[model samples]
Target: MTTYLNSLDYARYLDETDELRHFRAEFLVPERDGQPLTYLCGNSLGLQPRRARQALERELMSWQQRGVEGWFEGDAPWLSYHRSCQEPLARLVGARPAEVCPMNNLTVNLHLMLTTFYRPTGTRTKILTLAGDFPSDQYALETHVRSRGLDPAEVLVEVPLRAGEFHWREADLLQVLDQQADTLALVVMSGLHYYNGQVLPMQALAQKARALGIPVGFDLAHAVGNVPLHLHHWDVDFAVWCSYKYLNAGPGGVAGLFVHEKHHKAQAPRLAGWWGYDEARRFEMTQGFVPMPGAAGWQLSTPAILPLAVHRAALGLFEEAGGMERLREKSLRLTGYLEFLLQDINQRYGAPITLMTPPRAEERGCQLSWLVRAEGKVLFDYLGQRGIVGDWREPNCIRLAPAPLYNTFEEVWRVGEALDTFYAASRPRYPF
Candidate 1:
């Protein structure tokens, strides 16, 4: 068991933390009156980087000064604007620049990728995914299957985890793949499970699906910036992620897609949009479609420069912070501290607040999902009333994501202390 230090002492420890002290100033943390609230909910929506506003303002200024000419004349040329974002985004996902493109939102990218990859025919008509995928992913898969005249119940295979288990075992996942190999058309899972913060074994799952000739894709919304990923090296057929979560790219920011280079020459059918046309002849008012090579071919319409600008500004912070490796190191330590504090609270109250996130540091991200046996909502409200911010996910789980870039260890300690007080004063609202 980890020892819990006093909250006041933990605040002093934050003052001593070299990394902690430097990053807080970079973000525009929310405040009530003059005091900064202890913000730990970066998993949902990240605090804006101080530079994000400036970067966006620059784009607005360029639009005002040049109008359409801004695409070519601005300090950051708008025509090749997305090109500047490609390298850093590629670095984040460990993909070649040609293989990655920041375009559309998460669900839209999923549908586009599905149009290219989820080709169900012959015996391989089933789609396999986790039982508790994010709602958006589940909806995307269901619509895709239904559109193909296949019943979602029959064609969608949701591999269930063991009873009482918080995470799905890799071996169990592989077994499902093997059992359904003959009929499985696509195997899609989140790189990190959203509710529990479980980091799935992407490489292993991708390899197993490949052996069975099944295309594997990932919804990396929660994982891309939270964990270090090598999507291309892992031989994943395709993947999509939103930039707003750990990437801190702002609300409804432009999303990203990865298409392995091997698919570049294949005459795979896609849901085509005009913006995806070959740029060289795009202005020629071409009669026939000539798709751009690589991931750029997935573009559906002209890119949203505003959201992309926000993304560009946000990504600059990530590059300056020395990329995912350093950020992930801080994440592991910060989340570990949160887990430590929660366990201390559990000990004091004899509460059955079990952590749903994986115990191994490598098997999860910064977010920790705690299952409060009683009064979960009341506790959630209490935390919200105080300065500490976290989120509740239905009946029992309260997800607390101590983002590596901005959250302090002292903040984690204070949340633990606050929860302990709330639980002690309140009676159980629901018995589980």
Candidate 2:
């Protein structure tokens, strides 16, 4: 473990870090006044991988050199482009190659999956989700329910968190599943709570729901690549995740989906497109939809290859750097270090700045949500000005995510110090 003498000495500590030192060169880390921005925002947009430029340039060159033939000729043929991403992505999500498909953006894939899996009929028409899921997920569920002739008010149920808690406990979630077993068609929750970075116990939840014959899905927008997952082994019915966050793909990169093998042949609702047609006869242009066997069947349109190329480039880094296990080992230590530093800062302030993210290493990811007692906005902006790039949630929470792939222990310490300084300097005068 790397040790730091003071906050400013973190830079030297970063230099000494074995894993930390190598990955900095892999990304285009933005600089603030000649110093690299302490980028704690990988929970939003990950840093661009140095290899993406080469990957995209290869495609651009192929397009110029081969035109449409680029589909078949290049080092990476566009015809089988998405396949290149499958294994790496599957490894990240803990699914088999056949069970995972890299395609469509996050919401699009959600809607596509919902079309097949969220078949509501008779009593089993309701969709259950967490109360504060990502806005896009909520919209997709509500819209899908409405489209199926079920009122969102009646068919879409949101399981609320405990009054003072930041996330839903597994027991409470299971109880809801038990209560709604008859009516619940689908239960979708963020695999990791975005705002608080809680990693839901997906295996336990999935097992419980499956035993009751309920299909459970997960929106892994904040979880994938940030934490280790085993969607296949966990028997997750299906899952959707974006690549831009911890996956380090470029903005709006292609998203990924996982469908357990058990559902590969199951008769279910699905929205079809040509890309999902059996690859053997995809060019046959058949009138009837003969879908691919597994998760690939959920693909709706011919994927935008440019974004996929970028994703492949980023995924290669994950593959080369040993895998999620190695990344996660560092993540636990780095995040724990940040938590320790933050607690020190809270003590120094003599003000209540509580951490909303769970304390256990297993229950959380790299992100930490700190709830400032007062004037959160002022403190957030002040941290921004200081080049500590954390994000603020709507009310009083600030999220600092030190991604393991590219972030260092030193950056964690710097962010904590910046928060401490901001809290001390931002106290407003009382008009006595």
- Model 2 C-alpha lDDT per residue in residues 1-432, reported as the tens digit of each score: 444344556545554865645877899999977988889999999999998988888889999999999988967888778889889988999999999999989999899888878877789988878898889998998888878877999988889989988877889988888899999888888999998889998998899888988889999999999889999999999999999999998889999999999988876678888888888899988699988888888888978988998899899888888999998888887888888887777666664588899998999999999888777888788888888888989889999998887887677777767866666665453111
Best by lDDT: 1
TM-score of each: 0.96, 0.95
lDDT of 1: 0.87
> Tens-digit lDDT track for model 1 on 53-95?
8888899999999999997796787876888888998899999
lDDT of each: 0.87, 0.85
Q: Model 2, poorest ten-residue lDDT window?
A: 423-432
- Model 2 gets an lDDT of 0.85
